[model samples]
Target: MATSMRATINIARGMDGAIAEILLGAVKGQNLAAERLLALSAAEAPLDSNSGGTLIASGTVVPAAAVGDDSLVTYDTPYAARWHEDQELVDNLGRHYMGDSNFQNGRKSHYLVDPARENKAELIAIVAAGVKRG
Candidate 1:
């Protein structure tokens, strides 16, 4: 004995057009997310106790163009990596170093990471605002 079954999906508007609309919305959401991320990262970014420039000035965003795409925030300064990664203020020699003074305005390391983590809900909301659902 054997059993057979058949089913069909009747999409009134067709799947390709629907998928395209969703993808377009997702791109818009990603763009909004990138912009918000830049702002959040800037505020949480550790400012130099002295000049308080350069690194912050190099912040930028690359918005996504489709679903599953990446939205990136980048820093072009030479010391951007050092500043963003050195949470403990320790040098390669295993010595604690904070230059002349500590970061100003209560700012610390992981400037970009911390902000994204702390304000995750807000970031999601920003992106979700651009997406639409039935």
Candidate 2:
């Protein structure tokens, strides 16, 4: 004769649900932070020519609030990329490229970075507030 035994296990009820809610709250907080950064960066961006106001208009923020979601802020116009990279560009007259000569220097537009640095404290506060709300 032979005998067999079976075992069963059960997790605490609502544990997974509680954990999921906590995670979702954190994600929402992060998204709010990203949005704040994007707005600050755009506001601080330099505007001289304002030809099409494309540089300022191109500012955007992508919120990450789910698994595999990556947050990002971007100045998405074609020239915006070059400007952000500190690359030289031809003048409106197409005579010469800016930043090649000393008069027109190719300098990194710290539009996003500068604001982030200047408002580090404020941003931290914002994040803290978000956490508290969450």
Clash pairs, model 2 backbone: none
* Candidate 2 TM-score, true structure as reference: 0.62
* TM-scores of the candidates in the order shown: 0.74, 0.62
lDDT against the true structure, per candidate, is: 0.77, 0.66
| 1-134 per-residue lDDT for model 1 (tens digits) | 89999998799759888878767876788788878888888886776546786677789998776678899998887777877777457767899865433567867668888888888998888777766741
Over the stretch 24-109, how does candidate 2's per-residue lDDT look in tens digits? 66667667767888888766554536463567787877878584576687887776655554547666888755542221223236
| Local error of candidate 2 at residue 53 (angstroms) | 2.3
- Those runs of model 2 whose alpha carbons end farther than 4 Å from true positions after fitting are 1-12, 48-52, 87-108
Candidate 2 lDDT score at position 72:
80
Model 1 deviation from native, Cα RMSD in Å: 6.6
